[model samples]
Target: MNTTTIDKPATTANAPGGPVPVCHVIKGRVVTGTDVEYGPARARFATPALDLDGMVWPRREPGPAFDVPLAEIMDVLVQTGERLTRDPDGLLAEALEFSVLTSPLPRSVLERSYASLGRLFNRRSMEFQVQQELGGADVLDGWREVDGAPSGRRHRTRAFPPRLIHVIAGNAPGVAALSVVRGALTKGVHLLKLPSNDLFTATAILRVLAAVAPGHPVTRSFSAAYWRGGDEKVEGLLFRPQFFDKLVAWGGESTIRGARQYIGPGFELVAFDPKTSISLIGREAFESDAVLADVAERAAADATIMNQQACASSRVQFVEAGVQDVDRYCALLQARLGVERETASACGNPLASDLRDEIDGLRDMQPHYRVWGGYEGRGLVIRSEEPVDFHPDGRVVNVVPVASLDEAVHHANVATQTVGVFPASRKVALRNALAAAGAQRVVALGQAAMFETGISHDGFYPLQRFVRWVNDEG
Candidate 1:
């Protein structure tokens, strides 16, 4: 393992007039400015929450001086990956454990989530991403002609790294880690705007980087801080075109909307909007009693991803089966949602009261629609003729019975992120139409969250978008 003597500079976590510790990184330095104490908000659904302890966010120039060549960055990442693989109990692992304490996820879920991220760090995986996502690794070399000369002029391009501001969503810890990886792979000077819910993971990861390779280009090129989502003071200073080339945001409507004022000619916004996913189960699932049970189990697996907090988690199911068969499937799914697994359990997050009331109102008004499970929020299943009006989150799913698989396509829109289909063979029949309707991915029923390296995210190759394709003619 390549180890460097870590030089952690002495700095105050608490500012002179601040209450809690304020944490922010300036250049390569991790400084905690406690000039303000933001929140002791709910990281989980219950008590024993976390407080926002950082404040000072400084703006600085970003350009070639801050950029690390891709080759060097890749080497460092490879070394870090080997170290983590050899000793799972290193500082990075300890930091991840601390992050989990502030998260709402159960212990098993956190373990699974962390392991998934760990697998993404190898040299082969990074090399594969460069090859698959952006033609080839040579694209990082300046001005490579991608196509034969047209009309006697050579057309060449470079994937130039941009100065990016990543507005990370706090729903999942993986987002923070992935943002760091993406920033390093692209060799961009990353300024991460931490979400209120997650303040530990990114900072912890930064510390780990500093430890592994002190003052390394990857360390110097990264920064992270927190401010209110729409704070005019912070956004006004940092969002200016002079400071950043791109604002990569991952959040709901308000977060995306808040970034619009800062975007114009010099700056661009690459957004991963809030999306909902569903499952399409064909009638073939009921061909045998055994098959029906197995298919229902797979549907349950998709429905409970991150306890239904993930965009890829199936919130609804459109089953092309009879009412009786669908009901049997729904019952089986409800039971499966509550089962314990090494990474997660079906006994998940609590359902919001408003959603519970809406479910109750529907049950009261429509006698035809049957409901299973209570508002205690472990897991609930509602059988309805059409998709439910509300967003099905918190392990609650709406099983909508359809006459044919074609009808399920209507519910899919530009906002739909993933579609898990049963009888994997049917995916071929429905794939093109779903893509046309704006769905990004289609997976086998139980594999909504099981992603391989190099798959496009939210309908685009994100790494391809992360860098600026600078073109030159010869």
Candidate 2:
């Protein structure tokens, strides 16, 4: 309810000579102050101080959102989605301009990502997610009878909304929107700790909801702000179960490690652990020239999207091909990596000097290793008998020649989130083996980033972990 001049230059990144005011939305209220803070040195940008006091709800019982009808929340979300698509207030536009300074994504790619936020809020998507993930909306609304009990007693259960603190990732701006939608759909009181890389999208989406339905319980259930990760002063006070029920964290090892220290008996950690994706190319790709070209393009899509920054982007590919065919596929994939797409740019961030040096060292090793492309962001592919020792990034892909696709399974483990397989049909044969090896999702080549609704992420249906199941028996 606090009134601030949102249209003034002082409120946006385009401000004449000051750091932009990154305000916090606390339970349907906006709180802004004069304190200044900067993001990471690599992508530094200034923002106003976080309103820490406004973050936590006072009582232990559920907030107003717990009592709201499921149908009503859906309507408000659908309307909010419509408004987000139109971007009537230009918040999304302003956020995009601000985000480019913090995020590594190109302006065009960021625009496309922000443009897709509206689809997540639609009625059909929401209904399907609830039905598929939690069984149905009825379970969330109230208790439902269970059909069987060994004791011959009838029982009922509800997917009770939990108090969640989401440490959302910023690799792609869509994560902020998705987190907001999921939190609201589960009817939880969510405090989103926005990542420095994407400081605006979550707040922008929350503002859209606030405008669409002022004072609505669904809108009131949400809040978002930023703080340096691992700030003990802030985390020490809020991480207890009395204030929150779960810490839904997404980031690399360091981020997850920081959150792990706070976990205990009452509060749980639902971690989207750090993961890398890979690709498997069967012998079918080399059957014909046309087929090989098509397969290379598909492989490029999985490896180059988001400039290999996304967890789902393929960093390593195991191709069942000879020396000549594997080299040919590498060339085709390198050319396709620099092309523009909805989620990728023509040119991406340059490869790091260390990674470049490693690739340079491989040049002297004869038939054991072959390199194609360069470090200029047009994409780089290194073919070797084994995976590289260093992590691949900046549109760089490590291609390994495997005797068979089955051999690729040995390289997969708990840290592998996705495995993109060529010859779409090959997925059926490899999915079971891949899953046993700890890979959560086996996607068809080119479709690693194109996730379907109601599917599991990082080995589990997230919504199932986000809520508490309570049962009553008679």
Candidate 3:
């Protein structure tokens, strides 16, 4: 495999900061962030259990980046399920804590943070509502509609049924709210785990819940904290004979691999696996080069959405009727995207550099490549005769121009996540083909990133993934 990573300027991780305690809860199990020391204001989460011994968590920035010790967490998850009878709400309450803590980031701070992101894939609206509830699912209890008998039949049915642990992703600022909403509505208590990339948000959400439901069982039933995803030490405990009924996570390869090893005997895993995305263009793209330009730009924007970190961001394009037509379309597409700078939070030192190198390497592959912008600030563009083979460290794209949508989509790998299209009709022809070929989701040309909260992910409605079903036959 071609490994191209941009090298960042070296900086000390554990400068002078002493032990900084941040509370941690994994698989709905609580652990104070006591022993963890801060280190590396600049690093990536490649492993599990962060070693903050020499790290510094800066005040202005989201501090201390490190791996959650997968080995350690596996141990916990392995045993967590069987012990649920003892403290069923333990993990659920912790996640609630994280969701509440993260919801109210001072407008000034996150707006600035969002601005610093510089050309991200998705943008946040000024305001979003957070609905917190209980009994439906200790975690998802507050959804729009999720009760066994519905309406007035509440007295006969059991409320707040158990079974599920969620590991939340911080790719979007308000994701914790959504995840918690799902679990709560599904009636599952969450052992919500946060990504270090956006820990402040989770912490913010949790802080909110603690005040409102301080004494409730479900209130104490949840927990929110961070644990490197792959850590088996704690996570593994979930696999042994019903430690937890379910494990839900939003992750890529490394995190998935870690999940695989620890699924205990009676436990089930509802995974939203790591998938890639792409866009399809029909000869209909030729209808109006102007419209094509808009579509292309939007498609590219979809590719870079979430800095390309989101599984749904489009990565490749299938241009119909190749040649000068496709080339001209691509050129105009480039022109439109040339100066489009996004308002996204910049991932941090080494990450930016690493992503840049991946983009550069792809550019190098094609001698006909025409890079439009500089590597530093905003509006960065890299153009190739066809889309090149760029690695997605985030904020970079690998585009290819195919003669036909069929030729283009055939490249769909097991990782394909989203596919953008120009015409609405073509989706009918090729959608089944995509599913058979392993593609997961498809959206309109410009609407890829705006996936609604109501739709199902992959093949199933995720609320089902977050909550367990209990049947009592009369």
Candidate 4:
């Protein structure tokens, strides 16, 4: 581990002459910093240099050294998961808490997100995802024969873990952790490009991995560093096929666009594009007085995942009901959105100044649209005629009333990611249309926020796609 100290000036962002030194774990070793950069939340923090030597751009070779057995890797991950579960108050968790606190999200929102992330860090979930993605761990070994081959010859394939660069999103802490899990499981050497909004969770996870299995092969194959997203000197060197083969990016339009310039030929990009989720509630939701509130609560649950910041979190809800029933459902949804929950809650994302102004403007134009709830960081719903023109930010939702679920299908397109359908059975009726419209996932009503291991993210098994599929033929 390498550590460097820098003298702090009298006038600093936080405390007087206090240095907030952050470590970027590079290939099992910690690299400290002497350079300071103005980071998120107006805080001055150490910026560690990118160690691109044998770590990021390694000499690509065929062997188990770069690719460990799946069982052994899983064992190490199980130990890491156990530590996170058993010792929540341990040093690693504390570091994560501190890092999360510095984010612009409200304390309540961060608390809820972190708590939800804790549940996802267990062994069962990790193992399930591994099975879902790769079918079994043996595929990593090389050329496992797929069923149904030619008479004499054989068709065999393997998911080869290539050198990868994971640009992680910070909206939900789960993304960062999941990236590490995928990278570790694939046995890929990773250069995790930590997002500016979050620079802590990955480092903390790395530390836990080191603690759980000191000098383990899987633990040593990872590295993390931060630089301005478009830093030419850094990206130019690392983006080449010689250095890295794949870039797994998770972010909004800007992040995806930035990675595009460096993508071509041998350099592949597995992009989990920025997307908006929606809820389609059939008229059945409002069919009876008995189930009205239940449907609304589920719809609220779908919209409020990660306080509506997650890509899979529903932003638009198409209620296939009469005007009165739609109004009633909207009212119920507004109430449910304000209730506190471990996964999502009322103290949601704080609306921006311009958004507040826009909401205020829409307030005057009634009937066309009605704004429910407050601009005080609670949650807001706009009952609009069609889909709202602007992409809603914060905890704002746009409830569009439709004549039927078919009409709702027209609104969904490639940009739409997840669709939570009411009454569960409705998904069957609408699945083909939703899939044709480019929606990746459609879940049971109110379960848009819910996740399962091995679920195809963006219509593909991510782990299966992350590796280099090599073939052997006679």
TM per prediction? 0.88, 0.95, 0.66, 0.91
Ranking by lDDT: 2, 4, 1, 3
Which model, 3 or 4, shows the larger TM-score? 4
Model 1 Cα lDDT, one tens digit per residue, 2-60: 12111232233433332233356644666743334455433221111112212212235
lDDT per residue for candidate 4 within 27-113, as digits (tens), equals 777776635465544555656555556445446554223556777887787777777655554745565556754565556766555
Q: In terms of TM-score, which candidate is stronger, 1 or 2?
A: 2
Highest TM-score against the true fold, candidate: 2
Model 1: clashing residue pairs?
21-53, 22-32, 22-33, 22-34, 22-54, 22-55, 23-54, 108-343, 337-346
Model 4 global lDDT (CA atoms, 0 to 1)? 0.77
Off by over 4 Å in 1: 1-22, 40-69, 84-101, 365-367
Model 1 weakest 10-residue run by lDDT: 45-54
* Candidate 2, residue 145: lDDT: 94
lDDT of all predictions, in order shown? 0.74, 0.86, 0.50, 0.77
List the candidate 4 regions with Cα displacement exceeding 4 Å: 1-19, 54-57, 60-67, 115-123, 146-151
Query: RMSD in angstroms, all models?
Result: 6.2, 3.7, 12.8, 3.4
Q: By the TM-score metric, which is better: model 2 or model 3?
A: 2
lDDT of 3 by residue, 10-118 (tens): 2323233432234543322334433333335333211124322111112233111111222322222223222322334353344333333343222332444333221
Candidate 3 least-lDDT 10 residues: 121-130
- Ten-residue segment with the worst summed lDDT in candidate 2? 1-10
What value does the lDDT take at residue 309 in candidate 4? Answer: 78
Off by over 4 Å in 3: 1-21, 24-34, 38-160, 238-242, 335-374, 377-390
Residue-level lDDT for 425 in candidate 1: 92
Highest-lDDT candidate: 2
